[model samples]
Target: MNHDRSNRVCPVENAGGLDNGIRKFLQNPRKILSPYVKAGMTVLDVGCGPGVFSIEMARMVGTSGRVIAADLQDGMLEIVKRKIKGTEAEKIVGIHKCLSDRIGVTDKVDFALAFYMVHEVPDQASFFKELHEILKPNGSLLIVEPKVHVSRSGFEEMLKLVRSLHFEVAERPKVFFSRVAMLRRLA
Candidate 1:
């Protein structure tokens, strides 16, 4: 399906649905992220919706690490802000506002996650390129797109673009209902 980036961006009104008990059961942030995220490792959650993954990622990364919950919508970031307040995660997770076509984070991260959100990018190649630049050398990027919205061919097309930009396929880990691609930045 041809999707305009703006239309594909999840509206903040529906942000409540993005994080809930069922999603936790299916996506299980820790299980999907544990292998790549380590204590004191800085990570980025690109398009983090309501911080479902960000909060848990903070716990995984511990006090020394940082989880940047980057999103385009201020309301969504506000939701994350509220969720982390007065919690240990508040110290570890930082909410960042992104532009339509840019993540805009200056810090190099040990790992990055684009969960159910890459297809919404207006320019996939540029998106991957920026992701490549922001990642530390040999850093890992885990991209999980919803299978229902992204076709197999479309996902492969993205992979081709990602590889062309100096990212190698690290592994394809299984997530309940997602097309998963784990990539490593080539030094």
Candidate 2:
């Protein structure tokens, strides 16, 4: 785990470093992702440091939905709190701090996000296996990483192993596309 950084937080508010202005730049993803996420659905943001993505997704999913923003850091969750200020977001977001491979979330999530996080894991297979089991059937997992951090070939190899567990890349949206490959849970 070369992800050496301070990891402490509480998800009582918005986390910055990903403000709403920058978040607006992510509008395209919301359009592409709306079909997979719906009101009343449960969503999980894995490695949800600072919880920017979770806050955004909370707005998109509406009041009836739930968002579990799990991270190994509580300070990041506090950052998320400062970002969203006062809004409907305060209630929709839940925070969990855990470093275990099986994220201690009880919700049957319709979607899971591993934004800029998978590469930092000390155990990739164990992480994915746990994610695979937690997802509801027809759920989806999207992973985003810096294109500079890992070679494209190395990423593809890891993705291949995940595919064996029944995940298939539904979209490959270029490096600029958050350097991510969105995978749909098929099994």
Candidate 3:
């Protein structure tokens, strides 16, 4: 399916959904990521939006680790910055503004979360390639897309693109109302 970057959801709407009380209950960051995340493990929260998961992941990573919260909209990053201010999570979480075609993350990460945002990317191939480059050896990436928004065929197409970059499917976790996949870089 062809998508225009301009058609991406606005930052304001994204913030509402990301931090909604019911949504958090349905998509608890801790429960969804506990198996893969550990203390002192550097993580990347791709398409971090208002930092709901970023803050939770920052707490999980503790002071020794870092969470890079990247989003294409400055407004979204600003919301993340505001949400984390005056909290312990602020110390570990870094807000980054990324471009449409490049993530521009320099640090290698142990884990990356691309939650409900991959379908919005204008260039999936380049995005996955860059992600592959920054992942540490044995690192994992978890991708979750809303089943309501993404059809099975479209999600399968994305999996094909990920495999083309030599990423191996490690697991398919069940997420409420979402299609989830855990992938590792092929050594």
By TM-score, rank the candidates, best first.
Answer: 1, 3, 2
RMSD for each of the candidates: 1.8, 4.3, 1.9
Better of 2 and 3 by TM-score: 3
Cα lDDT listed for each candidate: 0.90, 0.73, 0.88
Q: On residues 1-187, what C-alpha lDDT tens digit does candidate 1 reach at each position?
A: 2332243788898987888899889889999999999999999999998899999999999999999999999999999999999999999998899999888999999999999898888878778889999999999999998888887888888888889999999899999989999999997
Candidate 1: Cα lDDT at 108: 98
User: Model 1 off-target regions past 4 Å?
Assistant: 1-7
The candidate that achieves the highest TM-score relative to the unseen native structure = 1
Model 1 clashing residue pairs (backbone): none
Looking at model 3, which ten-residue stretch has the lowest summed lDDT? Answer: 1-10
Task: Flag the better candidate by TM-score, 1 or 3.
Answer: 1
Q: Tens-digit lDDT track for model 2 on 1-187? A: 2223322222335444444565546534466456566888789988887765787789878889988888876677667666666878888888777674557776778999887777767777878888888899988988877665656676777788789888999987543535678898887
- Shift in Å, residue 168, candidate 3: 0.5
Worst 10 residues of 1 by lDDT: 1-10
Off by over 4 Å in 2: 1-32, 174-177
